[model samples]
Target chain A: MFSELLGIAIIFGATVLLAIPLGLYLATVYRGDKSWSDFLAPLERLLFRAGGIDARRGMSWQQHLMALLTINLVWFLFAMLILCTQGVLPLNPDANPSMSPDLAFNTAISFLVNCNLQHYSGESGLSYLSQVVVIMFLQFVSAATGMAACVVVFNALKEGTNEKLGNFYDYFVKSLTRVLLPIALLVALVLVFQGTPMTFAGKQPLITLQGDTTAVSRGPVAAMVAIKELGTNGGGFFGANSAHPLENPTYLTNMVENFALVLIPIAMVFALGFYLKRRRLSYMVFGVMTAGFLLLLAPTVYYEMQGNPAIAQMGTDMQLGAMEGKEIRLGAAASAYWGITNTIISCGSVNSMHDSHMPISGMSEMLGMMTNAFYGGVGVGFLNFFVFVIIAVFISGLMVGRTPELLGKKIEAREMKIAIIVALLHPLMILGGTAMAAHLYVSNPTEYAGWLANPGYHGFSEMLYEYTSAAANNGSGFEGLGDNTPFWNISTGVVLLLSRFLPVIGPVAIAGLLARKKYTPESAGTLRVDTATFGLMVFFVIWIIAALAFFPALALGPLAEHFSLY
Target chain B: MKNNFASAFRLTLALLVLCCGVYPALVWGAALLAPGQGQGVQVSHKGRLVGFENVGQKFDWPEYFNSRPSAVGYAADGSGGSNKGPSNPEYLAEVNTHVAAFRQQNPSVKPGQVPVEMVTASGSGLDPHLSPAGAYAQVERVARLRGLPAERVRALVDARVQQPIFVLLGPSKVNVLQLNLALDSLSGR
Candidate 1:
């Protein structure tokens, strides 16, 4: 127990320690100040020249969105084309077939939105060419897209009313050359040294000690797995994800991968502190996010370590605690810790099968995505939290009978409307999608019998989890859902698309509008957002809005399962 | 929009080369320094390749410590978990069946003494290690099957027990494959 606690503490402590320096470095890179990574400036210049992009040209908020969308559209089409014809492409040593059109649509949109909601298993579903060219490529660019958009918001938040923020291509290229590529390379090398396969070789046929012939899957997994966590893309190279021995290999590798999961998201918060010169405000945001993270994390770790009561009813020693869908090397505590981190950060990678977690733990996982703002995915996480901050600022301002002026910009009806819509959009899509799925399942049980792997409340959870994971732009799932069909693929694909862009547009628009407003200096009358009082207010607003909206849905799924089981 | 499209198209192509082509190739080059040349570390026994050192294989024979139940039947080519929710009746019944079978196989052990990991399936369907308690549970049955003393088998299990790194991270576990191979040498199989 002590070791398990220490294991999680070490992972969390190391991530925070690493995030601080990374945050400072991120601010430097985005600010275009000189640093150690300046050697990559030549490469960035070459790429910009090749693309005919003037890196010095500044962009308005609308221009930033346009560049982001156009590039994303191009990538989506490219991904679709490759996915549909991967069988004939090069590097398919296993000779996997092409995806059907619906699957291709789902997959392309999933990766493009930076939500790797894979309906198909990796080893069989994709050839090695698709794995590298489409999946891994999208993982890098999509995360950069989010980070670049975040920098736009950061520029807008600076103390000036200026139409010209910064060049979209500048932030985009620097995100790749400075932030993601260097870190990904470092992590990939570590994984390779730890024995994760980085070769182009296909599956190796082996004869077991028991004289049975079987084959082990191999690929350039080390490279893909690194960014899969680092960028918060969370697409696994194999069906079991990080649970696979070769993919993760050891406890040390698990720590590395887990550290990568939260590093950038947490760093972006500190980067906000440095970028905005609002260190107190950033610390308050970090504090609230950590408190919410631990709230969701504690129940999951406790429940997972308690062993499944249903299994405990049987005559067996469950000292290992709920080992059904967990690795022995990782143990239950670490897996529980990962479940919360992945869900909260919207990384959506799993080292354990969430479908088999104790009921309360499953609820905690869903709640993490439901809130979807606590240390969220890379750059987009803070954007999601930004909406909540706006809403909280407005609500608290109303209660105190004062105009909500955030960083000297007034929070008016227009900003409040956008914030509310963006906040409400999460629950609407999740609940609406799950309701539609539930209705479909209930109306004709026999027709969609294969949709669920388990019966009753747990079955409901599988459907709810899929939509929540999608709507949050989170890629993890309750794998028991037979979700590769046209119904699921198309529905979740639409959810992924809508959820990814609109939230981004709304936040950037609000920030842009506020940037154009007259900058009023701080005074005694201004409600200080950096104070502990305001932080608690924001925390309450998040729980009241995000958590309360999902309570009834919770009652029907994981909560129902918890009550019945325990 | 046209200007944006032109730049977007060019940038996308440029990034593909850098991200997919250059990056993975660099990692692959560095992997040459790793053990097994980054193809995965394989375990060989008596001049024959048995399996990967990290991937679990089936060992149903009475003389060997049986590996954990696998949802995919230990198929290394594909991996997955049972994904059975904790309260699913059918899944629970399956666990009970495993418990019953384990008790029947190891008759000297009490009904409640079986380690849960012995019955439950792992997430990867290829978990290579068992908790130290899981390995110790099978000592009696394996010793009886091999005509060896229980203490000798216990000592062998003890020798195979791998402590968590720095004794402060992860769980103490025994790799079933390595332990079984050591047992084979002990019994002169």
Candidate 2:
């Protein structure tokens, strides 16, 4: 037990320690200041020159959105074309069939938006050509897209008002060359050394020690797995995801992959501090996020370590804790830690099955996605948190009988509308989509009997979890959901598109509007957002809006299951 | 709009080559230095191909320490868990069935002495290792079937027990396949 607790502490502590230096480096890269990574500059220049992009030009927030959306549309179309015809494409040693149109639509949008909510499994559903050219390609650019959008907000948050944020293309290109690619290379090589496959060979048939014939699936896994964690794109090369032996290999690789999962999201918080030169504000934000993270993490670890009460009733020794749907190498503690970390950051890769977790632990995983802002997905996590900060600032300002201003810009009614919509949109999409699915399921249980793996309360969790994972752009699921049908493919596809973009647009718009307003420097009367009191306000605002909104639904699912179990 | 589209189109093409083409090729080249050259580490027996070192295979005979229950029956081409919710009556019944079968196989072990991992399905359906308790629970059955002394078999299981990195990082487990192979040599099977 001591070792298990120490294991989680060491992984998280290592991540934060690594993130500080990475955060400073990210600030340097985004600011275009000269640093050691300048060696990659010539490569960036070549990319810009070949594409005919003007890397020096500045962009308004509107222009940034346009560039981001247009390029993303290009990717969506490219992904669709390959996915629908992958059977005929080259590099398909496994000869996996092409996706049906609806699956393709879900997959294309899922990867393009960085959600990676795969309706289809790897190894058999996609050819190698699509895996690299479409899936991995989208993972790289989608993450860079989020980072670029975040840099736009960072540029806007400076003390003086300005229309021209940094050029979107410049930030976007540098995000790939400077930040993501180098780290991906280093991590990929480490994974390869630890026995994660990077070959393009077909599955190798083998005889087991028991003399049964079986074939092990082999692929170029290390390259994709590295970026899948680094980019917070949790799509897996194999159906079992990181839980698969070849995909994860051992405990050492488990620690490495878990480190890659949250490294950038935490680093971005510190990057905000470095970029704005507001270290105290960064500390306050980090404190709140860490507090929420520990709250979710602690209960999950406790319940998972306490073992399943149902199994205990059967007179079995559960000293290993809830070992069902968990790797023995990772054990219970690290698996629970990975589950919460992945959900909190929208990484969504699993080292253990969340569906098999204790009811309270399942609730914690759902809460992580429902809140969607504790060290969020790559660059977008900060954007979601920024929305809450705005709402908190407005409420605090009203209470103090003064107009709300954040970083010297007044927050008017216009900004509040956007923030509230973005906040409300999360629950609206999740609950709304879940309600629609439940209505269909309850209305015709026999017809859609295959849609759920467990009946009653646990069944309802399957549907709710799918939509919650979709709406938060978190891709992990209760794998028992049986969610490959057209209904799931199309519905979650729509949710993924809306949930990913609108929140991004909402925050960028608010920041842009505030950037244009006249500057009001900090005064003694100014609400101190950097203080501990204000941090508590933001924390409450998040729980009230993000957590409380889903309380009734959670009651119907994991909470009800918990009551029945004990 | 036209200029933006053209720039976006060209940039997408360029990035595809750099990311999908160059990045993977570089990793594939460097992986040549790794064991098995990034083609998955394989284990062999008597100079014949057996299995990948880290993937679990089914071992149900009484002479071997049985692997954990698997949802996909240890299919390596694809993998997943049983994904059974803890409170589901049907899932609980299934666990009860596994518990009964385990007791039938090993009559010497008491009802509550069975390790939970022996009956529960693993996440990947390809979990390579078993908790030390899980392996030790089956020591009596395997030793009786192979006609070896229980002490020798217990020592073999002990030798195969892998501690967590530095004994303080993760779970201590014994790889099931390796342990069984060691059993085969011990009994000169």
State which candidate has the highest DockQ.
1
lDDT per residue as tens, model 1, A1-566? 67988999999999999999999999999999999999999999999988999999988889889999999999999999999999998899999999999999999999999998999998899999999999999999989989999988888888985888899999999999998999999999899998899989999998998888899999999999999999998999999999999999999999999999899999999999999889998999999999999999999999888898777777888788889899999999999999999999888999999999999999999999999999999899999999988988898899999999898889999999999999999999999999999999999999999999999999999999999999989999999999999999999999999999999999999988898889889999898999998889989989998999999999999999999987
Candidate 2 error regions (>4 Å)? none
Which stretch of 10 consecutive residues in model 1 chain A shows the poorest summed lDDT?
A309-318
lDDT scores of the candidates, listed in order: 0.93, 0.92
Residue A340's lDDT in candidate 2: 98
Could you tell me which 10 consecutive residues in candidate 2 chain A have the lowest summed lDDT?
A309-318
Residue A105 of model 2, lDDT score: 98
The runs of at least 3 residues in candidate 1 whose Cα sits more than 4 Å from the true structure, single-residue gaps closed, are none
- Whole-model lDDT, model 2: 0.92
